[model samples]
Each structure stands twice: as C-alpha cells, then as structure tokens.
Target chain A: MSSLLNIIVVGLLLGGIYGLVSMGLNLIFGVIRIVNFAQGELVMLGMYGAYVCYLFIGLDPYLSIFIVVPALFLFGVIMQRFILQPLQNEPMMQIFATFGLLLLLQNVVLAVTRGQGYTAPSKLSEFVISVGPLNISVVRLVALVAVTAAALFLSWFVKNTMAGKAIRAVTQDRRAARLMGINVELAFMLTFGAGAALAGLAGTLLAPIYTMSPQIGGNFIMAAFAVVVLGGLGSVWGAYIGGFIIGLIEAFAGYYLDPALKTAIWFLVFIGVLIVKPGGLFGIAGAEEVGLREQN
Target chain B: MSKTDTMSGVTSTRDEGGAVPPGITTFNTELLRIAGIAVALLAVTWVYSGDPFILNIMAQTFLFAAVSLSWNIIGGFGGQFSLGHGVFFAIGAYTTANLYINWQISPWLALIPAAILAALVAVAVSWPTFRLRGPFFSIATIALNEVAFVLANYFGSITGGPRGLTIPFKAGLENMIFTSRFHSVLLMLGFLVVCLIVCAWVFRSRLGYYLQALHLDEDAARATGIRVLQVKLVGMAISAALTGIGGALFAMYLRFIDPPTLLSLPDIGVKFALIALIGGVGTLYGPLAGALLIVPLESQLRAGLSASVPGANLIVLGAILILFALFMKKGIVGLVMQLWDRFGRKSQ
Candidate 1:
C-alpha cells in the first residue's frame, strides 16, 4: 500500500513536469495548428537561458524565469512571423521547417556547449517532505504547485480576456475569425509567443532537476507529445490532466515493466487512444480532422 | 504550333490536336529514360572508378536516392508525411543482420524476408495511423520510431541491443561482402535502377493516379469512390518494402547495425524526406537529384566542419531544410521545370 502510494506521489510529480512541458505545445497546436517540433527546443533554450543567467550574472534559476520567459516570447514571435507564418497553408512544409528548427537549435547548442552537461543550481534542490513512508521533494512539489497555478491562470485568461477570446476565435475558424475582423495573424503571433513563454517557464523549473544537455529536449519532446495527445489538442485543462495520466502510466509501467520499455508501452497507449479517440480525451470530437482541413 | 511535352510524367497537359495527352508517356518511353539515366550514372561511376572516397560517396548517394524514391511513393505521391520510416529501415537492417549472423543465410536471400517483414509492419502500424491527417499522422509515426528505438534497445537478444550487431568480413559475391568499394557502388546503382523502374511504373499506373487524386484532396477522392485507406496501405507497404531492401544493403555495406545508427530520426528517417523534398516531392527523378546533391554536400560538410565543430553539418542541413521549405517548396526539379517552361515559351 505504501509502495502504491509512493508511485502515485511520484506519478503526480512527474505528471506536473510533463504537464508543464506540454502546456505551451497544447496552446500552439490548438490555435496555430502547427506541431511546433521546436517547442522542446524552446524549453531547452529556457533551461539554457537560466544557466546563462547563473553563469554571467549569478541569478537563481527561479528568478531567471523573468528574463527567460519574455525572451522566449520574443523569440517565438520572430519564429512564427518569419518561419512558420509563410508556410501556414502548407502543413507538410511546416513540419519540415519546424523539424529544421529543431535540428538547428539543438546542434547549435551542441556546438556551443560541446556536449558538456550543465546543472543550474537552485536553493530548492535539496528540500524534501516526508509523510508516512511517502517522501516528496520540495522542488517537485513546487513544480506541481506552479503547474496548477498556471493552469488556473491560463483557464481564466482564456475565458475572460479579449486576447484569449480572439485566440479561441482563431482556433474555431480562421476564415470566420477573419470575417469577424480579428487580426488572426497577430493573435497567432501572440499565442505562439505565450506558448513559448510557457515552455520557457517549464525549462526554468526543470533546470535544477535534470542535468542539462543539448539533447535533453528530445527526452521531453516525445513524452510531452504523449501528454498533449492524451489530454486533447487545444484544451488547456486537458493538457494539465493529461500530463498526470501519462506520468502515472509511465511511473506504473516503469515499475511493473522493464524501465527501458516504459516509453514503448505509453506509445502503445497513445496509439490506442488515437485509434479510439482521435481528438483526445478533452478535444472536440473531430478536431483532429479539422486541423487538416483548409482553414483559410 | 506543335511542341513535345517537357513535363512528361509530372502532370498531364492537353496538346492542341494531339490524340495522346502530353505528360502521359508510354511505359516504353519511361523505360528508355530510365536506361538513359542508368547509363549517365554508370558513366559518372566510371569516371570515379579508381577513387575510393568518391566511390563510397556515390554508393551512399545511390542508396539514399533509392530509399527516398521508396518514400516518395507514399510521402510525395500519397501526401502522407511520415517521420517514422527509420523503423522500417531498422527492421530491415536487423532482420538481414540476424539472418546472416545466425543462420549463415546469404544477404541477397535475406533481402526478400526483410522487405516482406517491413511491408507487414508498415501496413499494421499505418492501418490505425492512416486515420490521422496531416501533422497528426507525422506525430504518430515519430512515436512509432521512438517506440522502435526503445524496443530495439530492450530486445537485445535479437537486435544485439545497444551494443549493436556487426557482420564478419567474408569476401564473396554470395555473401554480399566485397573488398573493393566499386562493387558496393555497382550494387547500390542496381538498387537505384530497380527503385526508379518501380517508381516509374507506379507513376503511370492506376494506383499512381489514385494516390495523386487522394493526395490532392482526400475527401473528394473518397467521394469519387477511391478506397483511400486501401490505397495508402498499398503505397506504404511498397514504400516500406523498398526501404527494407535499402536497409539490408546498408547493413551489408557498413557490416554493422546499432539502434542509434539505424534509427536516429535526423540521420535515417528525416533525411529521406528531406532529400525527396529538396529534389521535388512528387517528381519521378526528384529523389535522384536530391541525393546527388545532398549526399556529397553532407559528406563534404562533415569532412570540413565536423572536426572543428561537431554537428556543424546538421546545422547547415537544417538551414537548407528551412530555406527550402520557405522559398523553394517545389525543390530543384520544380526550379528546373520553371526555367524549362520559360525557355520553351521563349522558343515558341
């Protein structure tokens, strides 16, 4: 019973990390309808941004979030404006372009870092709380708290704000949204920037936990994709909840099955979900097909 | 004004007072074109016959060209942008390596089973995944590649695990291992010829038309009574089988197979699509044009920049991919066609 409890706790913490990583992806995917293969790279850049802050200015990883998030937002806007916006109509080109960005960012970092692993030290890295055979790291707890707060904030933002409503309108129908006089492109640029900013936030939080490598984005990318799919495309709450589902599955699968095979196992689950519910748990029934339709 | 079709096998164009439409060339003419291309490639091979470096590069170029041609069947013609073909390539490599290592089976004989297994796996996975459209399909395929990578690592007994499998050197035609680089070049050239023939045949066949129709508009194609799923499956199977054969040849040529070496997304999976895209997605000879340019350029970059900065080659390749996607969506073939059209019009 204690072990099961431990697994649940572990899963929830892991889910927090996954959820945080996937939030930005879900937003971009939901609104822009581009997979943004480089989102993980954006997260990686955020981690590095935190590292650079520590290296040059001696800023804490947590405080670096202020600098990193806005930087990534600007970066995202530029990328969407220059790279993705032109290829908006061509989904295939979008995939190629984003993948190109993935390779470029990853390798550029690799060349700069020379594959050396860096760890961004944080004051919160060593604290842990124990409750009746269940031990929780404070850093993880912080991530969980941050994700919940972010989710609530994002939900509220999307619900109440004019900008959020505009994003929703764009997601629903690009042509109709355009007819309503919404500058769909500006909305996309903002959404992408916000999404990138969220990814930056995830990176800052995650930096202290994992040894940073140029290829670390790869580790999160597939898992985040699983989270995004499980939760549903374009659904904020879905990504939050979906992250935990994947985390629990991964945690349970890792313990029960061969640890190495956990990724494969969840991939099977992802495929099954795709087969059974193509739109994901929280996604509209046919949103998966809707993404492929000529929105313009 | 009488003019011959320049964009033969690309798009069907009605010619004034002509019974046969331009771009719908007879099979014999395509065969002749293939023969001409083969001869041209052979001449290039003859020029670099003595240089081992060029021979190795040529061999790889042909191999990748063939694999990209296979990818074109589904990715280009059918409009399914798969990012998981590395799975099929790995399947082929491991299957052949296992057969040759364990059973003393000839690599040539192993090719048949490898192709069949790849096709089977392709059909099985794509059956469910075909329901996904656009980037969703790509995401699923990428997941499949990752799954294969994990499984390949775990199932060490068969795949030799992360340590990978290396075949012993035995110089013989039957063994498909040779000391001379020239022989490998010839073998790859032969493979390239076979892929070209198959692609050409498919390009002109009913299946090709069906694939193109669906590619243009899936719902409309379905409305017209085209069996969308079946057509995609058949195309994927054929593409996977050819990729499998290419993998077998790759394993034999390298005499080593590892999870990362075979299944790396950037190196194996995306490279095929990149070549196809850079050449011309749907054009018959695009893969060849792409391979001819990309393979040599990559090797040169690796030689020049890799020592100074690791992954510099990929940085350039990535930039090329982005630039191509942005400005040159139609790729080298498309550019050539536009120029050809201008010249033809000027002459008229």
Candidate 2:
C-alpha cells in the first residue's frame, strides 16, 4: 500500500515534468498547426542557456529563467519567420526542415560540448520534503507547481487577453481571422515565440534535475509527443491532465513491467489512442484531418 | 517513334497545342534508360575495382540507392511519409542473420521469408496508420520506430539485445558472403538493378497513376472510385519487401546485425527519405542520383571531420536538408528536368 502511494507520487512528479515539456509543443501544434520537431532542441537550448547563466553569472537555474525565456521567445520568433514561414504550404518540406533543425541543433551542441555531461547546480534541488511514507524532492514538487500554474495562466491568458484571442481566432480559421483584421502572421509568430518560451521554461526547471546531454531532448520529445497526443492537441487542460495520465502509466509500467519497456508501453498507448481518437481526448473532432489541409 | 521526337516532345507539342500534355514514355524506353544507367554504374565500379576504399563506398551507395528507391514507391509516389521503415529494414537484417547463424540456412534462401515477413508487417502497421494525414502519419511512424527499437532490445533471444549480433567470417557464393570487395559491390549492384526494375514497372503501371492521383488529393481519388487504403497498402508492401531485401543484402555485406546499426532513425530510417528527397522524391532515377551524391560525401566528411570534431558530418547534412527543403523542393531530377526544358529544348 505504501509502495503504491510512492508509485503514484513518482508518477505525478514524472507527469509534471512531462506536462511542462509538452506545453510548448501543444501550443505550437494548436496555434501554428505545424509540428515543431525541434521543440525538444529548443528546450535543450534553454537548458544549455541556463547552464551558461550559471557558469558565467553564478545565477541559480530557477533565477536564470528570467534571462532564458525571453531569449528563447525571440529565437522562436526568428525561427518561425525565417525557417518555417517560407515552407508553410508544404507539410512534407516542413518535416524535413524541422528534422534537419533537430539534427543540426543536437550535433552542434555535441561539437561544442564534446559530449561532456553537465549537471546544473541549484540550492532548491538539494531539498527534500517528507509526508508520512511519501518523500518528494523539492525540484520535482516545484515543477509540478509550475506546470499547474502555467496551465492556469495559459488558460486565462488565452481566454482574456487580446493576443490570446487573436491566436485562438487564427487557429480556428486563418482566413476568417485575416478577414477580421487580425494579423495572422503576427499571431503565428507570437504564438510560436510563446511556445518556445514555454519550452525554455521547461528546460530551465528541468536542468537541475537531470544530467544535461545533447541527446537528452530526444528523451523528452517522444514522451512529450505521447503526452500531447494522449491528452489532446491544442487543448490546454487536456495537456495538463494528459501529462499526469501518461506519468501514472509510465510509473506503474516501470514498477510492474521492465523499466526499459516503459517507453515502448507508452508508445503502444499513444498509437492506440491515435487510432481510436486521432483528434486526442480534448481536441475538437475532425481537427486532426482539418489541421493538415491547406488553410490559406 | 524517333529519338528526337521523344527528346523534344514537350516543346514541339507545346507549339502545336497551347498546353503541353505529359510525355508518356513506354516500358521499352524506360528499360533502355535503366540499361544505360546500369552500364554507367558498372563502368564506374570497374574503374575502382582494385581500390578497396572506393569499392566499399560504391557497395554502400548501391545498397542505400536500392533501399531509398523502395521508400520512393510509397513515400514519394504514393505520398505517405513513413519514418518507421527502419522496422522493416531491421526485420530483414535480423531474420537473415538469425537464419544463417542459428539454422545454418543460406541467406539467399532466407531473403524470401525476410521479404514476405516485412511485407506482412508493413501491411499490418500501415493499415491503422494510413488513417492519419501529413505530419500525424510521420509522428506515428517515428513512434513505431521507437517501439521497434525497444522491442528489439527487449527480445534478447531473437535480436541479441543491446550488445547486438555479429556473424562469423565464412566466404562463399552460396552464403552470400564474398572474399573480395568487388564481389560485394557486384551483389549490391544486382540488388540496385532489381529495385530499379521494380520501381520502373510500378512507375508506369495503372497503380502508379492511381497512387499519383491519390497523392495529389486523397478525397478526390476516393471520389473517383480509387480504393485509397488498398492502393496505399500495396505500395507500402512492395516498398517494405524491397527494403527487406536491401536489409538482407546489407546484413550479408557488413556481416553484423544490431538494433542501432539497423534501426537508428538518423542513419537508416530518415536517411532513405532524405536521399529520395535530395534526388527527386517521386522520380525513378532520383534515389540513385541522391545516393551517388550523399554516400560519398558523407564518407568523405566522416573521414575528415570525425577525428577533429564529432558529429560535424551530421551538422553539414542537417544544414543541407534544411537548405534543400527551402530552395530545392523538387530535388536533383527536377532541377535537371527544368534545365533540360529551358536549354535543351531551345537548342533543338
């Protein structure tokens, strides 16, 4: 019984990490309707960004978020404007381009770092809090809190803010949004930026917990894809809840089954969900089909 | 029926009619072209016969050209961007390796079962995934590759797990093992020729037209009474079968089998599509053109930069992918066609 509780806790925390990693990916998929394969690389860049801050300025990984998020936002905006926008009409080319970006970013980092692993030191990472038989690390707890807060914040921002509304309008119908005097391009750019910033946020938060490697992004990207697909595409709450569901599944599977097979198990669930509900749990029905069609 | 008529057909017809109809080349003409290409490749192989380094590169080029051509049957022509082809490739490699090692069966015979099993698996997996469109399909395929990777590692008895399987050296004609690099290159050349013939046959067939139509618009194809799922399944099966044979050839050439070597996305899965894209996604000769360009360049880059800076070759490759995606969507064949239309037609 105690072990079960521990597993649940572990799953929830893992889910929190997965949720944070996937938020930006879901946002980009939701708004721009382009699958950013390099979003994981963006997060990887953020983790490295935080590391640079810690290395030079001696800032904590938590505090470095201030510097990293906006930088990533700007980087995202640049990538959207230059790389993705030109190939907007061609989905096949988009996949090639982004995958190219993934390899470029991953290998460039490898070249620069020479494949040396680094751990970002944070005071908060060292703390642990125990409740009865359940012991939780503070960094993971912080990630869980951060994900919940970000979800609430994103939901409110999309609902209330003009920029958020514009993004939503663009997502719903780009032509209608264009006719209604909304700058669809600008909205896409900003949304991509926000999505990238969120990835950066995830990176900064996660840096202290895991040993940083150039290939670590590959680890998060697959799990995040599973989370996004399972929860629902473009649905904020769905991503939040979906993260926990995947997390719980991974945790239970890891404990019950072979730990190495957890990824395979979740992948099976992802494929199962994709076949059964292509739109995802929270996505609008038929959106999956509609999203791929030419919008302009 | 004249050579000049076929060469200058597009422009000559354009002058007669306002809009040019697509030049329909017969199977005999395609066969002649294939023969021409084969002779040229053989000439190059003969020139480099004594040089082990060049022969090794040539062997790899032919092997990948065959695999990429197979990918083009479904991916380029049929318009299904599958990134999980590594699974089928791995299946072929493992099957051939296991049959040769465990049962002492010849790889030549094992090739039959490998191709059949690969086709079966391709049909089974693609049936469900075919429902997805564009990026969704690509994503699902990537997931599939990951799943296969895990399963391969898990099933230690079958795949030999993470440590991988290595075949002992026993050179013979029946074993599909060669004592000389020249023999291996010739074997790979045979594989490439088989793939080229299959692609050419598919390219001019009714199924090919149906695939092209569906690739343009699935709903419209369905409306026009095309069996969308069946056509895609057939194309995928053919593609997977050929890829399986390529895998068997690759296993025999390298005399080694492992999950990463066989199934790595960067190396095997994506490389096939990348080669197709670089040469001409849907063109018959594109994969060959692409493999010719990429394989040697990659080998050179690996030789030069791998010692100084790890992953420099991939950086260059990644940049090239992005640049090509932006500037050259139609690839080398498309560019050559365009240039021919602009210059060769005018000169005539």
Candidate 3:
C-alpha cells in the first residue's frame, strides 16, 4: 500500500509535468493545427538552457523558468516566422519542415553535447519533502503546484484577456478572425511562442528530476502526447485532466505490471482511448471541424 | 494497363489535376520505365564492378529494398506510418534462428512458418490498433515492438536472449546458408523479384485501388463504398508477411540473430522508413530505387566521414530527410518519372 501510494504520488507529479509540457504541443495544434514532432526537442533545449544557467549563474531551476520560457518563446516565434510560415499553405510540408527541425535540433544537441548526460545542481536534485507517513519530493510537489497554477493562469488569460480572445478567435475561425480585424499572423506567432514557453517551463522543472540529454525528450513525449490526445485536441483544461488520468494509469500499471513495460502499457492506454473516444476524454466532439483537417 | 494508357492520353490532350501535374504521367506506366532503367544500371554494375565487396553492398541494398517495399505496403499504401515493423522482422529472424539452433532444422523449411507466424502476430496486434488512426496507431506499433523485445529478453534461457542465437556453419541450397556473396545476391534478387511481383499485383487489385483511395481521402473512399478498415488490415497483413520473409532471409544471410540489431532504437526502424521516404512513399518501385541510392551513400559516408567527424553522416542524413520532406516529396522515383515526362515531351 505504501509503495502503491508512492507510485500514485509519483505518477501524479509526473503527470503534472506531462500536462505542463503538452500544453504547448496542444496549444500549437489547437491554434496553428500543426503537430510539431519537434515539440520534444524544444523541451530538450529548455532543459539544456536551464542546465547551462545552473552551471554558470547558479540560478535555481524554478527561478530559471523566467529565463528559459522567454528565450524559448522567442526561439519559437522565430521558428514559426522563418521556417514554418513558408509551408503554411501545405500541411504535409509543415510536417516535413517541423520534422526537419526535430532532427536538426536533436542532432545539433548530440553534436554539441557529444551525447553526454547532465544532471541539475545538487540542491534541486536533493530537494524533497517528507510528510508524516508519506514522502513527497519538494521539487515534484512544487512542479505540480506551479504547473497547475500555470494552466489555471493560462485558462484565465484565454478567457479574460483581449489577446487571448484574439487567439481563440483565430483558432475558432481564422478567416472570421481576419475579417474582424484581428492580426491572424501575429496571433499564430504569439500562440506558438507561448506554447513553446510552456514546454520550456516543463523542461526547466523536470531538469532536476530527469537527466538532461539530447534523447531524453523522446522518453516522456509519448506520454505527453497521450495526455494531449486524451485531453482532446486544443483544449488546455483537457490536457491537464488527461495528464492526471494517464499518470494514474501509469502509476497503477507500474505498480502491478513489469516496470520495463510501462511505456508499452501506456501506449496501449493511448490506443484504447483512441479506439473508444477519438476526441479524447475532454475533447470537443465537433472540434475536428474547426481545426486543421481541412488543410490535410 | 488501361489506366496507364488513358492517363497518357489525358496528359497529352490537356494538363489537369493539380495534385499531379497533368504533364506528369500516371505511376503505372512509369514503373516499367523504372524497371528498364534499373536493369540497365544493374547490367553496368555487374560487368564493371569486379570488387566482390561492392557486390556485397549491393546485395545488402537489395535486402533493404525488399524490407522497404514491405514497409511501403502498410506505411505507404495504407497511409499508416508504422515505426514498429522491426518487431515483425525480428520475429521472423528469431523464429528461424531458434528452429535452426534447437533442432538443426534447415532454414529454408523454417522460414515458411516463420513468415506465417510473423504475419499472424501482425494481424493480432493490428486488429486492435488499426481502429486508431495516425499517431495512436504509430505509438501502439512502437509499444508492441518494445513488448516483443522485452519478451525476447525474458525468455533468455531458451531463446538465448541478449547474447543472441547463431546458425551452425552449413553450406547448401537446403540449409539456406551461402558460402558465396554471388549466391546471396542471386537470392536477394529472387526475393526482390517476388516482392516486385507482389507490389505489381497489389497495384492491380481491388484492395490496391481501395487502399489508394483511402490514402488520398478516407472519408471519400468510405462514401464511395470502399471499406477503408478492411483494406487497411489487408495491406497491413501483406506488409507483415513480406517483412517476415525479409527477416528470415536476413537471418540466413548473417547466420546469426541478436536483439540489439533486430530490435533497437532507430536502427532498422530509421533505415526502413528513411529508405521508403527517400525513394517515394506511394510508388511501388520507389523503395528499390531509394535503397539503391541510400545504402551506398550511407556506407560511403560512414566509411569516409565518421572517422574524421563522428555523427557527421547522421547530421547529413537528417538534413537529407528534411530536404526530401520539404522539396523532393515524391522522392527519387518520382523525380525520375517527372524528368522522364519532361524529356518525353520534348521529343514529342
């Protein structure tokens, strides 16, 4: 029971991270309607960024989010403007371009880092909280709170803010949004940038727990995707909920089944969910009509 | 084929169809042209390149071509990007490898059942997962492939696990192990011939027509009375069977089987996909042409570059994929066909 609780707690914590990272992936798909296969590599960059900062400036990872997020956001905006915009007319082209970016980013990191593995500073790695009869790592607990708060804050931003409304407008109907005098291009740019920032934030938080490597992003990205699919495409809240559900499933499966089979087991869950509800748990039923299906 | 003749006449009469430039001829007729070109190329290589090592590389390329062709049936034809097909290849390798090791059974005899078993496994897994399209199906295949690897690891006592199993040194047509590279080349040619025939047969079948339709537009195909799900399953089965055979042959050629080579990150998985994508996705002859270009380019690059610059070729390979993905989307075969159209027009 104690072990089970541990697994559950760990799962929830990890799920929160998954949710946090996937928010960007989901947001880009929601607004821009492109499945950035490079999303994982972007997270890898953020982790590396935080790692570099930790080494040089001795910045705490949590505090480093302020730096990593903005930097990544700027990178994301530039990527959208320079690399992605040319292929906006073609969906497959977008996939290829981003896929190129994914390969480029991964190999560049491998080349630069020489595939070396790095861990965050000792304090961040060691920071853990032990409650009575329960042990909760402070890093993860803080990550969960931070991620939840970020998600809630984004939701509020989307609901209340004019820029958020314009973003939503673009997502709902790009043509209509254009007609209404919204700068659709700028909206897409900002949306993509913000989404990338979220991925960076997730990476910054996760750098301490997970070792930073060129290939590290591939490990959790699959689970993050499962969360995206489970939450329903383009629904931020759905991503958060889906993350927790997948986390719970992972926790239970890891506890009950072979630990090595955890990834495959979760993939099975992904397939099952896809079969049962293509739209996902909190997915918009007719949302597919609003998104990039037309482009494909 | 009537379709080819009609398409040619259409291209000559008026330019139409934006997806395929009207001046661009249909793929059916272009395949024959590809075969003619391939034959000429092979003849040149056969007469000139006296080096057995070069012939050896070509043999390996032929084997990869077969694997890529098999991948195309499901991935290209069915429009299902499967990253887990290494599982089927591994299954085929393991099946024959185990049979040869334990009973000293002839590999030729073992391979038949190995192919069947691989196909059966494909069907079993695909039946549940085919319902989920796109990334879900892809991830499931990846997961299942991993599961196969894990199982292979756990059963180390009998299966030989990570250490792998090796076929005893035996020379004969019966044993399926060859002493000469020429013999392996002949065997690979035979395999490629069979796969090509199968691909041509598929292109002429109702299932092929349905698969192409579904690939282009699933909803449209469904509306037109094409059963998209059934066709996809059939394509997947055919694909699995072909890869299984390729795997069985691979075991015979190497006379050894290991988990790391058979089932691992971005080894077979990357190569097969890269070859298919590099050649052309939908065309039958695309993979063959792709493997021909890529395998040599890869070997040459690795031999020359990796010594001076570690992972240099990988960077180049990634760049090439991106380039192909962006610009040469139709791949080498598609390019050949396009150029053929352009030149053929000038002569007309």
Residue B96 miss distance in model 3 (angstroms): 2.2
Tens digits of per-residue lDDT for model 3, B11-120: 33222333355424454644554455445445644653567767777677878888888888888877777878998898888888888888888878887888898889
List DockQ for all candidates. Answer: 0.89, 0.87, 0.36
Regions more than 4 Å wrong, model 1: B1-22
Each candidate's chain B TM-score? Answer: 0.93, 0.94, 0.86
User: Candidate 1 has which clashing residue pairs, if any?
Assistant: none
| TM-score of every candidate's chain A | 0.99, 0.99, 0.95
lDDT score of residue A57 within candidate 3: 95
Clashes of each: 0, 0, 0
TM-score of each: 0.96, 0.96, 0.88
lDDT score for residue B134 of model 1: 89
Report the C-alpha lDDT of model 2 over A155-251, residue by residue, as the tens digit: 9999999999998998899889999999988998999999999999999999999999999899999888888888888999989998999999999
lDDT of 2 by residue, B163-231 (tens): 888888999999999999999999999899899899989999988888888999999999999999999
By lDDT, is 1 or 2 better? 1
Q: Candidate 2: where is the Cα deviation over 4 Å?
A: B1-23
Interface RMSD of 3: 3.1
